[model samples]
Target: MLRNSPLHPLARFLLNIISPLEGNTLSAVKNTQHFVRIIKEQHVTQQDLLVSFDVTSLFTNVPTNKALDVVKKKLSEDESLEHRTSLSLNAIMEMLNMCINTTYFQLDDEFYQQEFGVAMGPITSTQRYIHGRL
Candidate 1:
């Protein structure tokens, strides 16, 4: 829901710019079809097995505090966020924490609030996946 907000894209863009680059990762599979093309080009035979797995309910499974810690660590290591942007790294980190920590849902005359884990529809989902727990 908040993704469509006017400031969301701008925040996302800024985050993308300031965040430390992963450069290469297994998660790149989500970004392109080249993995298949490469496998085909290499003539991967029936004997050659591929082992790939995805975590189900990742949004609910990842611990938000851990994810935030990873972001905070990476932010501290990368100096650009402080010098180039008006937002403090701690402020940026808190914003991410706020985004993921305040999750909730309603189901069948019941309401539940998430005490941990990222909220649905956040751009930071990829970060949680990449960094894992602190």
Candidate 2:
């Protein structure tokens, strides 16, 4: 269903707009290899501590409204956004709302609409955006 949904293209478009603006935060890891390299380079002793997190219901826990606000603020503050796309921030925000807010899914031949948080598949980076903000 996602392949044919009008929002799919819009999601891609929004991703294109926001992705470049998603400047790397200090906590972000590019991939497992990079993370492993960093870990291997770290000199750990008895005083050093290592911790990990396992978030439950990760995508569903992200507040769509708050995520949108973060995206908006990021876009508005991004100096390179104009160089990336010709679309106004308002236009991008409108499409983002449509993509994030109008998600639906099917289960057991029954259609269900999400009432809160980011949808599971569409607009995957939304989770990252929310995580950085929240």
Candidate 3:
């Protein structure tokens, strides 16, 4: 169904423009510099003891299903659809459908499949923007 959709390219273009602003390479460099500065200022030594923790599947825990449900409910409740012309409503519906269908899969057979729908309304992209696979 998605492959037959004509609006997919437009949806992808809009997503590229609206994805989250975090995780930029420049931001990562800046963050590293700031961290080093803080360490130097605090005189934290390796012998002072360091504790590190790692999280697995951090973004996967964001409740994408819940987010998708909320978006669908809000769209259904909007009274604007009643006043808008049929053409306008159709355009909005197309975008919503595209948003709902957007997803990516992992290549490894052992990895869990990753799927995401609308996590933020039209202005924001899904949470797994920088996934290594897709």
Candidate 4:
């Protein structure tokens, strides 16, 4: 079904324009110094605990529809910030569907479509932007 969809390219294009890298709000640690400074500022104590989250293959785990719903809510709330972005929430959501819903993979020479789950890679930050708010 998705393989024949004509809007797919348009969707991807819109997604590219609205890509999250353009507005990275994260103060991503660039080096050991930044990591050390953050850790030092935390003032770790003997009673305090350290934690690490494992999101390996996390993209395949997210339910596409539910995540999309969350993205919709986020978009609605952030509508006031629309001046920063040209695409409407509807356009972004539509592109998101076309981007993630049509994922196809090969197995022993056969191709199968992924009906659910968000695709990984460039879409990762978008996923974080939507989910991190919750």
Winner by lDDT between candidate 2 and candidate 1: 2
Ranked by TM-score, the better of candidates 2 and 4 is: 2
Please provide TM-scores, in order, for all candidate models, with all chains considered together: 0.55, 0.75, 0.30, 0.56
Score candidate 1 by lDDT.
0.59
**Winner by TM-score between candidate 4 and candidate 3:** 4
Pairs with steric clashes in candidate 4: none
Q: Which digits, one per residue and each the tens of the lDDT, describe model 1 over residues 86-108?
A: 77777777666655554444444
lDDT tens digits by residue: candidate 4, 10-74: 76565554544333345567667977887887777799999866657676678889977866775
**Number of the predicted model whose TM-score against the real structure is largest:** 2
The lDDT for every candidate, in the order shown, is 0.59, 0.76, 0.46, 0.60
Ranking by TM-score: 2, 4, 1, 3
64-123 per-residue lDDT for model 2 (tens digits): 889999899989988999998999999999989999888776554655566667777654
TM-score result, candidate 3: 0.30
Q: In model 4, how large is the Cα lDDT of residue 68?
A: 78
In candidate 1, position 28 carries an lDDT of 49
Best by lDDT: 2
